[model samples]
Target chain A: MTDTSLIDTSPQGSTRRSWTFTIGAIVVGLHLVIGLSTLFWTPYDPTAMSGGRLEMPSLAHVAGTDRLGRDLFTLIMIGSRIALIVGTGAIVIGGLIGIAIGLLAAFASRTLDDMLAAGLDILIAFPTLLLAMLIVASSDGASLWTAIVAIGIANSAIVARLTRILAKRVLRMDYITASRISGTSWIGVVAIHILPNIWPTLLVNLALQFGLAVIAEASLSYLGLGTPPPNASWGRLLQEAQGTVYTAPLGAIAPGIALVSLVIGVNLLADGLRDIADPTRRRRR
Target chain B: MSPLLGIESLTIQAGGKPLVSNVSFSVAPGERLGLIGESGSGKSLTALASIGLLPDGLQASGSVLLDGRQVVGARDRDLVPLRGTVAAVVFQEPLTALDPLMTIGRQVGIAVRRRAKRDGHPTDSITVMGEVLDLLDQVSLPQPQRIAEAWPHEVSGGQRQRAAIAMALACKPKLLIADEPTTALDVTTQAEILKLLGQLVRERNMALLFISHDLPVVAGAVDRVVVLRHGSIVEQGPVATVFGQPSHEYTQSLVAAARAFDDALEIAP
Candidate 1:
């Protein structure tokens, strides 16, 4: 059942060799490895203030020390971990909630479908960051979990809208009708036919959402609405580095590069997956 | 005695307008009935109504008795399990009828497994695979083993249609409703599929409700014919009486169209 040889491997098999996909995988892999390794060890303790404050890059501290005299490299490593957590957590919550709501809307009767459409329209009109801010504020200041939940909820509206449209299109297919005629239960029809048909498009959308989630977490942290003190996020590191920009430009540059690299990796991956999933597009290319 | 499948005074309304009004028909065991009409003539709607698969907002008010069971107004839970086993359908477009993402084996295996479960038979993977291969073989597909492993898109249109037919017959239904099943195939393939269906229905002693717009095609396969025009049954009787001497204007015109197509084909280089 899990045989790869049984699959139609012409288009998807080549996707891994595409430059964008390969590069994206490399960058994302590096981030994940660094982030996970931080669970056990970093070059120096992330919170310890042993190095001289505002030190330049040197053998003892390769990326140099921060204003608190803690290792900048260690802080960035922990920051990557935070980014991974928020990115994974927010996407899981958003994708699940959004896909479920979308399926409900697609399966609902005409009147209820209209109501859900209208409600989704209203939600989509509300900017995600603004909604996240409101949620965070309502939850009484930022923490790691609160920021993740807020971002997740905010991101869910977009995913729900996309899922509703994709699922509706899938439900209209003749195979879906045939599946129903074959006595497949509604849930079985959804699981076997509807979900698989809509998955490629939804996956591409979710990948794009992952990049946005990382950026949203960073923005929230920058605004002092994410991962409150004692933990370093890439966004928080940027915030802490802003005061000493001229003296230590690497402080701002390092986290900025890291943030941009991760987002780029995700976007490239989405592009590659989109090409592979849509065979017509892949053929044209 | 009640027929194997029956419909009486079936009226389908969409947005307060009747699409199919006051239509009635029935098929007994081993009967081959043809439903012939032009597009939008409610020929397909009647079949869809029988299967309880009418689209949303389209309401049907009447009696549909399948194997002595009331299908019209039956809950989906009741209709769902009754479908495929009681009365299976072969849709016109084979490409869209089969799931593109799944292998032909997997799709056929699902139907086989459902039938197995209903019959209280063992449903191990090997048994399912053997059943799937047997179904593919029953449809006269070349290389049943390779065909089972192939995806729907990997097979030709005719093969796909055969695969669809195999899946439909997996449950060994009492009545098989084929709605324009061969419309998408080539002339030769169409004839072969019609012959295959005729042979299978005879061998299994299953009732067949064969729907098509072609009169000659209907003549070739069915024992009786029902002509529909603008949501009404124009004329219906034994195929010999209807085709040999069509009474209604609609039936005569349909027969004329079919004759003209045949004449044109004969004249082609």
Candidate 2:
């Protein structure tokens, strides 16, 4: 019913949108290539040491060596694998749980709504980082995924709250009313009428949530609150490089740049989805 | 004669405030009864309450009977089976009454399919489409198939109302509750719609509960007229008796207000 060619163009009439898309595609492409290459081989084992520590861009090490004499380039590649995994995992987990709670609160009126809202409010009131740290302390040590799950759990209340408010408003719209008037039950109204319209909102919101999740997981790893040693996350690599900030600053600078670039790429991708998913953008076009 | 539709002492309270209180009305099969009143006069509330479709938080009492079977106090589970089988509705703001996202054809097909599934009636989707086209033809919608394929927004106000009439008829319900079905339409479209509805009622021998604020439209379209003011039945009788000689002061005032507007429509004071 719609022309694919028209959709190919980004919502921002400006060329910046296309440039951002190209940059995102390249970063994502590099991330995938870097991750999958681990299944095959890196120039050197990511954790293996070469001749000496702080060996700058030698013929053998490619991107130079860390304080521990580990190849910085291989560490960067391996770190991306964790970043992609945690980022994707957190969004899926948080999005699904949040949407379930949201739909329940929106459709089930009064007492159920109050119960869910109160639960979310309590969770939201707690400090996310301190709560995650406390959880990690109280529980066993966290893995890369544990940090991701903790951050995702901490942030799900925002998604749930936003989804509930949006869903409740949508529940009162004429289309939903028509569904009920047509002999469709409340469950039917939500599944058939409400869900379809709110899907675009969910998608755009997911992109933003995933971006935040990546940053959270990376920070926790850097603070030694994430996946234990021998696991390389962007945060852990950056943490390991802290002692070498003087002579071999590239040890910190390389992973640091990777973390910022990945975050920037995800945020840009989210902006793109926002423009496309926004219904108002349709009229603008 | 058995009334095709009967509402007895229908009381509806919204937040402890009565919207329709102690209201009673009935219509025989093949008969048309107009419930006339000003805006917010409980006429529409009575119609909605009769069908057990009033919004939540509204309390309803009294008996609504269809084919002599009480329905008003019936359970939610029980009320649904009778919905499209025994009755259907046509509402004001035709486009809003319809699902804007669904095609008119699908809407009609849904009603027909629901009825056929419930009753074990013969139902080929194509046959149902043909039947819908026939209804659209009956409502005088030119290019019925094209109109059926169009969304509610694509059509003019008149076509949307015609589509609504077609939907209300899709299940072949014996009672059709038309609440301000013509109020949003233009004059020529209003005249055509009222005439079409009148003809449909006669042709199918169905009972009609016509709710509207316009006195002349109701006067011309119905056999009996019940005047309501502030949730109470003020006056009622054979259309000629009630309109020619209203028994209650509120009824007279309603007629006077209607007459003052020169058959266009009166703004109720």
Per-residue error (Å), model 2, residue B22: 0.9
Tens-digit lDDT track of model 1 for A18-137: 888778888888899999999999999787896999889999988888898999988988988999899889889999999999999999999998998899889889888898899999
Predicted candidate 2 versus true structure: per-residue lDDT over B179-198, tens digit per residue: 89899889999999999998
| Candidate 2 chain B weakest lDDT stretch, 10 residues | B260-269
| Residue-by-residue lDDT tens digits, candidate 1, B63-132 | 9998889988999999998898888889899888888778889998999998999999999999999999
Q: List the residue pairs that clash in candidate 1.
A: none
- In candidate 1, which residue ranges exceed 4 Å CA deviation? A1-21, A267-285
Docking class of 2: incorrect
DockQ of 2: 0.21
* TM-score top scorer: 1
Instruction: Enumerate residue pairs that collide in model 2.
Output: none
